[model samples]
Target: MPSSLTPPPVQASFGDTDVYLFREGTHAQLYRRLGAQLSPGGEGASFGVWAPNATEVAVIGDWNHWSDLADPMRARADGSGIWQAHCPSARHGQAYKYRIRTRNGDVLEKADPFAFLAEEPPATASRIWTLEYDWQDAHWMGTRGAANALDAPMSTYEVHAGSWRRKDGQFMNYRELAHALADYVAGLGFTHVELMPVTEHPFYGSWGYQTTGYFAPTARYGTPQDFMYFVDHLHQRGIGVLLDWVPSHFPTDAHGLAHFDGTQLYEHADPRQGFHPEWNSAIFNYGRHEVRSFLISSALFWLDHYHLDGLRVDAVASMLYLDYARKHGEWIPNVHGGRENLEAIDFLQELNRACYRDHPDTFTVAEESTAWPKVSRPIEMGGLGFGLKWNMGWMHDTLAYMREETVHRRWHHDRITFSMVYAFHENFVLPLSHDEVVYGKGSLINKMPGDSWQQFANLRLMLAYMWAHPGKKLLFMGGEFAQRREWTHEGELEWWMTDQPEHRGMQLLVGELNKQLRGEAALHQLDFDEAGFEWVDANDRDNSVLAFLRKSRDGQAVLVVCNLTPVPRQNHCLGVPLSGTWREILNSDAKPFGGSGWGNLGEVRTAPLAANGHRHALYLTLPPLSTLYLKRDADV
Candidate 1:
């Protein structure tokens, strides 16, 4: 049984200009017109959808008792395949779906692609919700350009909101998590917090990567307004927010974008081009004009509505190659007969252009693994336009080298120094991200090859080296305090580990590293320029030692020395650029950092003896498995 009320008169929402831009694939604000939006007077809601192949479409919702025949929509005469309807009884806070009658007489129910809010997982319906928030981050908005500058000190704390922390083993609301995360991140002195995808997805295991709702945030935490509060609160605390966005592939869920209007409207019809073999998902058809508009709109939607600081695009390598995970006969070459995905490349360039053109203060990062050229360069430079690219080569090489026994590390000494050959290839972010700690990979502390004490020492040394390396820094959530196990979405982090002395020391070391990274101009002011780095000593393979200098634009310098072996070295002479008192700014082997307390007694003076191509040298005692930072005293 259905209500006998007559449907409201058809009110067209899309004008000629919107249609032209939408068809031309340049519409960046489709959310304003395509989704279920309430009228100005709050009387009823207007709906618009694109189903060119459908014979009939209707609005089915709680207001009409989920009736398919109660309200029928009209197709535009312009043959743009757009369907429109107005339901006087439909109001805000109601669940709805489109009942589309296919051309061959089949009925399909699909959720709104531009939905602002969606029902929690296991209930696949879109909720008609408004995005009205009273933001109090004007100060952050007006001045974030400086905080997000290329020369700024940028260290990110990567978090998965569902598993970051919980209350009584239950998920915390966005408002509650906002305060908790802001306090913790601000205390650690990280400039930004990069959240694993928050876009709505049906499977929690995918961690928001297999996204279904492009324009909506998962209701598992809270409403759209609640998520807004999360960003606002972080900004007020002087912390920026970056979201992980996935446009590489999508799940083939029935109610999702797959087979919309009884056709492959959003994806490729051919299996070779549409299918993702590894994930068993459907790849997007970037060549389609309307699909391009949809994806670019989704990317800008976050920056426009949520006031986010940036987007870290996930699995960009998958999108750039046609033969990404395919065999020889299982792929299609571009029109130029090459392996490059030309259409996707164009889409990426256009996406970056739109994001920067609309929101100049925000940035976009690429998680590209291959040796793609100039990923972080500008579009005019004939490269993929991104603000930063993850240094996957550095992460893999360093971790592989650390996993080997200390006795065998000297043979692989090139692993630690090879990154310097192409260190300045692109604006890189040295990321120790969640990918390293998942599956059977083990935790960061356990990755070090040594006894308990030596393992902790090695971990500390690695952190110091990463901070002094030639790029920005990113560490996953549990790595800050050395969570003992691999990461799983089903459980929260091991918060009790912080109570232990060894784990607490790791936490303290991270905070100190971040403090020094922010406080010392020589550490971060010229992270991307080779001019900021110099090899003080790189040929000490027998000692398994390495040293380098990080300099600022003003010639201020900090020398970093690493002793990888377990045996201490006494009277080790290291060359210096200046003859003055070198103050020990940081030592990973200090007693407070859960070490054996072997160091150079806080200071060392240079002598006239030449070593390592320098006119002056300093005699020092290097601790076991330690990395130290020494800066020349300006007042001396």
Candidate 2:
């Protein structure tokens, strides 16, 4: 019997990709597996759909749903504008979709007029397949820096397989995706592919977040085998794959996981623990043992089955609270009297531990925003055991500096400083993701403060500083090109703009930057070491600049300076380690990264005669919004 405190059952159903939770006391673990059980080996039958507004809708064929004809739908009553039926005779082989009603009913939503991988007979969705995929990621290693190789500096390429490519006016299948995505990411120099959820879904606009099937990849892209092929191809190209694991909540679809198998088999038996108030999605009861095993097994399933490198746990903040959206008595309290959702935390820890245990190198990053302590700390330390937690503070702080009034930022130096205190405690990634430039936020390019020239300079300066910072780094797709407009997931990258001098300049800068990142003696060597960092200067707001240094463990020193002013500042004083000639090895304002021609290249600068008391000193002309990397080899 369900508990009286159990939340009301939501109006949703089950399909593939439905994430369920296993609970124990106040803890829950998440699962990321794939599979659909419809009475093992049941004969083919028509799987019906209910899409209102469609004066008429039909069932399309077929995977392993044990369905018959591709066109079997029974209309519904109560004017729900729905139609549904079953196809028991249809085998799971063909592609399918619905003949939904158009606004004018003249032309219906025709199998994604821009459909990439469509089935014949022009259906709406693919039949659920029960086939298996074989994969091998022998060459693609995992994690880095004591952490799993999968958790290192992850510059992920976020992609929607269907809209990412189109040839012959049709969407490509999984095989096509493997080839296309591989080429794109390899060329761009991204290390991982963070694909939009691949869970089987029905809507094109939802971007796969509203999943319909928990255990199945969307047949829209092709077969499950093709998806695996994509991962394999990514590994062959030296790139890793990170799946978007959404265990926080679920979409409320009628034929989905909700209330499936004659009960709330996949969701929480009680309403209190299994409902998400904000997203209107079904939540999981993290207190069930069965749910915990299911969630943990799912994570292991993906790593074992797809040879995936990692998982980016989405909406983690939503999962760690008992009163996420509640204002009153609907929620319960833990032993501490706090309103924390203890079950979710438990499940999360279990999932992290299991993933680490199964594939010691598999990485897990939490997309958590709240000030949850020790989120990235080890499990034995009484913390959630994610391999890396998004350094959201870095993202928000950096973006705020770029967007808000700069004059106000001086007082907010502590905001940026706060990032470093926790940076070394656990693995962190400085991310500039899709969230930064969506809606009214504008693109990175548009966020530039000064004119076009200053904008590019600022962007480059920030990148240079970011690379020099002590932690893993990530930049969103199109950011490398200094995209001018906000991102539109529906459109392809603004590749056409690559021809522009500024855009091309940004591209070249990224390439060379990455090259330097690997070859430079200052970078890539003991970068994450706690002792390798120091704050040399921060009071340069008049010039709107800041300077810092990254020291090698072997005593090799590298100095970085940034000048954000429009006019070059003469004899700018920057405190340094050595009073000798510090050669300028790299500068952002140089023509290399599409900035104004104001830059000094390879200029071994002479230091000031007088010292700053503590370390050696240097006084050099700093260009506006330019970043310079200087290496001091000798102690003069």
Candidate 3:
């Protein structure tokens, strides 16, 4: 293929204005002018890169038989470190790399930092490409602002595209996966699918976290246009797409951004500041104006070109704290002797601000696993300005309590109820993410402590409790059903397990939970407000029972009750604010969910008996290892 989609040879260069804006770190649309663009005269492609430390830079590819000096590039007049060259011989399908002669007299070939497509791993060559997909999701785009509002109902299904499904032992391409994934997620009633990092990476085992090409989607799945089709198809099915973005660190591959231009240009000079000891990656130099411009531009590229709905930032905790995952004498403190990475703080704030500015309806979530204050608050109020933060504390506490034997669960009652102490500290998403089910941690279902039957019951109860808890919800794929094995990036999920009744029951429970969450305002309308939640009976540790009420801004309310132990509680009295009939809106112990069917027949009449600080009370049967959702009769 030709290096571009144009007609003939023309001058390919970045103007002085482009250099100035890039130097000032204000060029959010740098992709427009940088990288390989079709020539205006319609002949070939314009290749550009930033390599100030290089004595000479040339475009090398199959078109020139990989000759280093076949296509020499010119440096910009401005001192912005940009180089450009027009390759009339380079076509759309041609592979290319920048051959740079470093000041040290070493010639190195590096992949284009702005390449739209790249050859699959084991071959590190940038491809001259163009994206031209006709999107048919205008309705989804126009209405997404309201659909993705903070107060809206959001049940995200976090998925790793490569492992979700496969055919003939091979990964499904983006177009094929789109049709199947959209139908499956939509049928399960998930409002959105949060994909694990889909950025291009050399090592598939990293699960796309160690990105090499920030602007390009992984070719393992499909072409860039095909990934766009994946997003568009989901949009048409009324499902939003949230991509996992890793701006915190990048892999140390030779052709990657590690030592671009034969210097510490993208990362810091010192290992303590730039190197990630745990992951063996390089932390980006967030303070550098040009590097900041690069990262911000990458984020904008996805939203602008791909029409993505949101970005879920990864490893935010590591980015925020300079001492994260480090021992004594292994890290440096800020000027104030604090652990905070001041530069990263500024970058994240600016990132969130720019994202919202460019796309008002889109959101950014922080995968920060710390007690960082105001992580989801507005930047104007001295906060990091993220739309949401993963509720790591809730996930940890709930999982710890659930893993305990049912007989001993009463002793750990506080673990289950302690999350409400600071539930509203920031906007939160109760996430049972991919991290929970990998690296020998066991699958979500396997984490439960009980016999086979009780394990399924416990899994259903945990999910019910998670949905009814005071936050938005996120569950990793295969968690909807009771998959018994931990997740592996190399293989597909155990989809065949769903044929079993117990597994199918868990899937049904999740589907119903999503439906109820969307239909009930009390479940989602005021999730971030303390006033929306009230304790009905949080002090029943002796019976291993807990009850609470979720309220909308309006008068509507739904009561949630849970029995963590296998011993059922009979004639359980829970106070109700309303005097009308309260029906069993959902019972995890119902027969359909493969439970013992120990629940109220249908509804319970609220009696005018003073209990648990309310004038009216309802007597009901609480099933073993189950959660129940009750709603008041609207007709009363």
Candidate 4:
């Protein structure tokens, strides 16, 4: 090949505004400019990369027989430290990498950080590809704002695509998973589906958490268009898609961002500030302006290109505190001599701001397991500016309370009741996520303390309690059907378990709970406000019974009562806001849900006698180890 085939560096196709904003750390659309982009009519491609410390850079790919001297890139004279070149022979679907000569004369070949598609893992080369998909969810895109609103009933089904289902011991393609997942989620009445990270990673065992290609979806499933179809299929079925995004840390793989250009260009030089001991990963240098732009741009790219409804940021607590998972003196303090990660905090605030500003119809959630105040509050109000936050405290306390024997549950009643004191502190999502059912923690069903029958009942009761509580809901895969084994990425869920009566009953109960949550305004409309919840009897320790009212803004209400022990309580008097017939909307102890056929006979009337501080009260049967939802008959 003649040397003239490699043209001299020209001005980037993207404008100078992108460069200015990138340097200022405010660029949210760098994907359009910095990555390998196909030229018009697919004649060739334009390549751009940022490697300020590189002494020389060249594009080596299949088009040029992987020759390092074939297409040498030229550095821009604008002092932006960007190298660019045009290769007319570089067509789509060609594997490529940048060979960089470090300042100290060492050479390194790195995958494109902003690649839209990567060669399937076990092969670390980036592929030249185009993102072109004809989306068919115009109706979903037009009105998703209301469906994703705070008051809307949001129940998320967390899934791992590779393990969600496999065909003949092989991973299902994105298109196949899309149809199967959409059918399953819509049938369960869940409003949204939260996918674990799909970003490219060399290790399948990481489950996509140790992400490398920020802008590319893993090719293990399919192409970028395939992933787009997955989202489009879900949206068309009225199920929103939320991606679990990891901006906290990345793996220290040799082919990843650990050391680019023979230096820690993307990470801090100091081990104390750059390393994550717990995850065995390298933390990004959030203090760098270019790094901020890169992270934020990755976040926006997903929502913009994939038509995703929201994002659930992962490991936020690790980003918020410098001392996270580190022993004394093992971590470095911020400039203020505090343990807080000030640079990371600023990056998070900016990320949320940019996400909301660009996609106001969408939302962002934080999996923050700390007492960080105002995590879901507005940025202007001295907050982190997230739309929702995972309720880790609630998950831990509730599980702890449930694991105790019925006879001992009264002593630990506060564990179940304490969450209400801080429930309204932030917009919360009561997540029984994958983290709860792994590493010998046991499946959610096995966590209960009881015989086979009692275990099933306890599982149903716990799920009912989560639905009736004040917050949005999220349940990991297999938990809905009471899978007895712990979750693992290596295998698909036990789908055959649903054939059993007890297991199928649990599935039916979850579907019913979701239906009730969406059908009744009181169950979800005021999930984040104190006024939506009222304690009818929170201190019934001796009986191990608790009752509360979930009210809507329009005065509609649902009365929820839970009996912790396996001892049935007949004629359990509970207060009612209305003086009329109260209908038993749902009963976990009903025969259909693998429980003894014990409950109030459909409905009960409230008498004039006052109880639990109400003008009228109802004496109803509360089943053993069950939760009941009652709503007053509007006709009465």
- How does residue 192 of candidate 3 score in lDDT? 94
Stretch of 10 with least lDDT, candidate 3: 1-10
Off by over 4 Å in 3: 1-13, 40-42
lDDT score for residue 182 of model 3 = 93
Structural similarity to truth (TM-score) of each candidate: 0.98, 0.78, 0.97, 0.98
Put down candidate 4 lDDT per residue, 248-359, tens digits, no spaces.
9999887789888788888888989898999999999999988999999999999999999999999999999999999999998888899999999999999999999999
Q: Give the alpha carbon lDDT tens digit for every residue of 1-636 in model 3.
A: 122222233364577777777887767877888888866554678888988888788888888998865688777656788888888778877889998878887778899888899998878888888888999999999999988998899999999988999988999999999999999999999999999999899998999999999989988887899999999999999999999999999998989887888899899888899999999999999988888889999998999999999999999999999998899999999999999999999999989989999999999999999999999999999999999999999999999999999989889999999999999999999999999999999999899998998999999999999999989999999999989989998789999999998999999999999999999999999999998999999888888899999999987999999999998888889899889899999999988888999998989999899999999999999999999999999897
lDDT of 1 by residue, 508-573 (tens): 889999999999999999989999999999989999999999999999999999998898999998
- Local distance difference test, each candidate: 0.92, 0.64, 0.91, 0.93
Highest-scoring model, lDDT: 4
**What's the best-to-worst order under lDDT?**
4, 1, 3, 2
* Model 2 segments more than 4 A misplaced: 1-137, 141-153, 163-165, 168-170, 269-272, 405-416, 521-528, 606-614, 633-636
- The clash numbers for all candidates, in the given order, read 0, 75, 11, 0
Candidate 1: list runs displaced more than 4 Å: 1-9
The total number of steric clashes, by the backbone 3 Å criterion, in model 2 comes to 75
lDDT of 2 by residue, 1-636 (tens): 111222222122222213222222211212112121122365543333323444444444444242223343444444433344444444444455444433344323223211222332223343434435555655464422222352134456676665555666477888887887788777766667787788666666666776655545677777667878888888878887888877777665544545432345456766666777777778866765655655565566677667777888888888898777776887777789988878788889988987887777678889888778888788999989997787788888777776544445556556555666666766677778778878798999888787777678778877877777776666777788887878775656677788999899887777666656655545645545677777677655545667777777677767888775567877777777665678777778787677666655565555554443435567777877777888874754
